[model samples]
Target: MIQIGIVGVGTVGASVARILEENQDIITARAGKEIRVRKGVVRNLSRARDVAIPLTDDVDEILDDPDIDIVVELMGGVEEPYHVVKKALEKGKAVVTANKALLAYHRYELQDVAGDLPFEFEASVAGGIPIIKALREGLSANHIESIKGIINGTANYILTKMMTEGVDFGPVLKEAQALGYAEADPTFDIGGFDAAHKLLILASIAYGIDAKPEDILIEGIEQVTQEDIAFAKEFGYTIKLLGIAKKVGEFVELRVHPALVPQREMIAKVDGVMNGISVIGDKVGETMYYGPGAGGDATASAVISDIIAIARGGKSSPMLGFKRPLESGLQLLERDAIVSRYYLRLVVEDKPGVLAKVSQVMGEQKISIETMLQRPGEGETATLLLSTHRCEERAMQQALHALFGLESVKERPVMFRIER
Candidate 1:
């Protein structure tokens, strides 16, 4: 029998325990043993829980227990969970986690600490999608070319509502919160930090590259307006907040931002709260994994899969991780060095020289406009929307800065990278 200890019996932890008890017969058969939740740790003891397992307030009860064979750290936070998981590894306990923020910062260090130990985190990236295993093992033989995903359900939900209903970001965000799709603060999800954390985890498995959220370009969907959605539809594009990881020569490009993807692309079709990841492998070409990004049951399904793997003694995780991507000496691509087409929106005074000034700024930066649209705004103001030819991010940003300084320009121009 495999004894499991849950360090945080929150939403996912409770689901893990409930599922284990509810599906014991099949779980035991698949795991080759009886896998049960022995105990759970929670911050509050007065709160009632639905699981049948014994609950405790102190994490040490589970950590110090001798009979526990696996330690499931569902605790959310960076440093605290890191310390707990490190100690769990030190005590010779196998670890499975769903915390992407923790892995984004300390994955390399944890890899060093859990040497030869069975450490699994399939639930960290995209809930029950199993993209992590697909990258670390199934596609290990091939060199990973690129990974594009709509990993954060909250952000995807907001963007989908904005496009389908033509609603503003604020109203859609409020509806998402009321529906339990977003948090009260919503900064982490709407700001793209949530997706950024997940992308870093995938990048480590796919490219063997170690980078934190600070190293990559992360832009939120909060700045995206209803007009932006209209522009996307008019230009045969769909706006989606995408977590992109690509191998460009010797450098690995990792970024999370709102992208204007052509409507025809499969990734653009992934809408609502569903998460979808499209991985391009040298041998497998393009493969897509889609499922509920986050729900208690969906995420618990992934956590239990790791436990079953541990029970069956199938160690295929960090065991080959960072090493599976065989491509070596790859460095993180600088944010400014990225190259892509861009969509820009600016509100300026309806004057003759306004277009000339904008064109002259683009000309100076060596950026050529591909398509342009103009709409009258409040009073003498006009909204100028344009898409540019492929250009380096350095040049495109310079042009935006110059345009913002123009007397005719009213507000800062919004930019969204266009993906073909």
Candidate 2:
């Protein structure tokens, strides 16, 4: 029998306890051993919990108990959890965590400390999608080319509601908070940091690259507007905040931002508080993983999966899927060096030669316009939406600068990447 100690009995922790107890026989059969939740550590013992497990206020009890074979850190913060996980590993305990922010910054350090120890964190990336296992084991033979994903459920839910109901962001965000889809302070989710954290984890595993959340280009969905949504509909595209990581000739590019995906793609069809990741590899062509991105039960399912692996005495594979060190001395590709199609919405003065001036600026930057739309101005300002052929991102930045300088262009243009 494997005895487990769970620290932080919150929603996910409670779900883990419940699932283990409810499915004890099946889990035992699959794991080849009976796993027991020996103790649970929490800040407040007085807080009512649904699970019937024994609880303790002292985390040390779990850490010091020699019988506890696995320590599950469901704690959400950085410094403290880092210390706890470090201690757990020092005691030779296998650890599992769902804290993406902590892992995004400290993965390499943790992996170094956990040398040859069974440390698993399948729940850190996409709730219950098994993406980590898929990349680490199932597709181990292929060289991963690129990954693009809709990894943040709150942003996805908000965007989906906005697209379907023509609702503004503020009301929808409030509703999401009320329904627990978003937090009281949703900056982490809405500002794209949550997705960036998850993306960094995936990038590290796929490329053996240690990337911090700050090192990547992260743009939130706060700037997505009804006009942009309308334009996407007209162009037969859906706007989603995507976490994109790609390897290009010794350089890896990582970014999380709003993207215009063609309606025909399966990833674009994933809607409403769900997650989807599309991975293109050398041999597999293109493969996608999709499921509930977040929730107590879903996340708990992943945590339990990791626990089962440990209970079954599975050896730790290379956390990043590759055993050899990734080629060193290679820099992460600058965002400006990336090349892709773009969706641009410009508020311009409704007069002759405005379109010509915009086109001229794009031409100067060597950017080709693919599709164009002009809406009648209510007053002196008109809306011009243009989709461009594939071009270097630096060229688009320069074009935006030139367009902003033009007297005919009213406001700063809204730009989003177009994914086919």
Candidate 3:
């Protein structure tokens, strides 16, 4: 029998215990042995929980227990979970975690500490999608070219509502919160930090690049407006917040932001709370993985899969699925040097020379406009919605700065990348 100790017996933890108990016979047959949840650790022991396992307020009760063979750390945070997982590894316990933030910051260090120990984190990236296993093992034969994904369900939900119903950001966000899809603060999910953490995890497996959330460009869907949605519809495009990672020569580009994806693309069809990842490999071309990104049951399904792998004697070769750097001399591309097509929305005074002035500023920065649209705004203001040909981010940003100085320009221009 494999004895398991789960820390943070909250939503996912409770689901893990329930699944183990309810599906004991099948789980035992698949794992080749019976897996049991011996105990659970929680911050408040007084709160009633659904699971029948022994619950304790102290973490050491599970961490220090001799009979426990595996430690499941579902607790959410950076420092505390890191220390706990490190101690679990030091104690020679196999660890499975769903903590993406912890991995984003200390994955390399944990890989060092968990040498040869069966440490698994399939639940960290995209809930039950199993993209981790695909990148680390299934697609190991090919060179990973790029990964584009809609990994965060909260942002996807809001964007889908905005596009379908033509509602604004504020009302949709409130509805998402009321539906339990978003938190009260919502910054972590809506601000793209949640997807950024997941991207860092995937980047490590595919490229062996050790980068934190701060190292990449992360922009949320909060800036997406109804006007942007209308423009997307008009141009046969759909707006989605995308986490993108691509290998460009010797450098890898990682970014998370709202994108104007062509409507015909498969990824653009992934709407509502569903998560989808499109991985392009040099040998296999492109493959898509789709599923529910998060929930108690969905995430628990991933956590339990890791347990089954460990049960089948899957040794921990390397946490990031590499013994050494997969691709050396490949540095992370600087954000300012990124090149992509862009969509810009600006409010300008309703005058003939406004468009000319805007075009001149873009021309000075070496940016050429691709498509343009003008709409009547409140009073003497007019909205100028335009898409630009591919250009360097630095040049486009400079042009935007120059446009701000123009007297005809009104508010700061909203921008989204156009993905072909």
Winning model by TM-score: 3
lDDT score, candidate 2, position 79: 87
Give the TM-score of each candidate.
0.98, 0.96, 0.99
Residue 31 displacement in candidate 3 (angstroms): 0.3
**Candidates by TM-score, descending order:** 3, 1, 2
Query: What is the per-residue lDDT of model 3 for residues 41-112, given as tens digits with 9 covering 90 to 100?
Result: 999978889999999988888889999999999999999999999999899899999999999999999999
lDDT of candidate 1 vs native?
A: 0.92
Least accurate stretch of 10 residues (summed lDDT) in model 1?
Answer: 319-328
lDDT of 1 by residue, 106-127 (tens): 9889888998788999899889
After TM-score superposition, the amount by which residue 374's alpha carbon in candidate 1 deviates from its true location, in angstroms, is 0.1
Clashes of each: 0, 0, 0
Which candidate should be chosen as best, given lDDT against the real structure? 3
Task: Report model 2's TM-score to 2 decimal places.
Answer: 0.96
Candidate 2, 190-249: lDDT as tens digits: 999999999998888788887788778898989888888999998789989899999898
Off by over 4 Å in 2: 327-330
Which pairs of residues collide in model 2? none
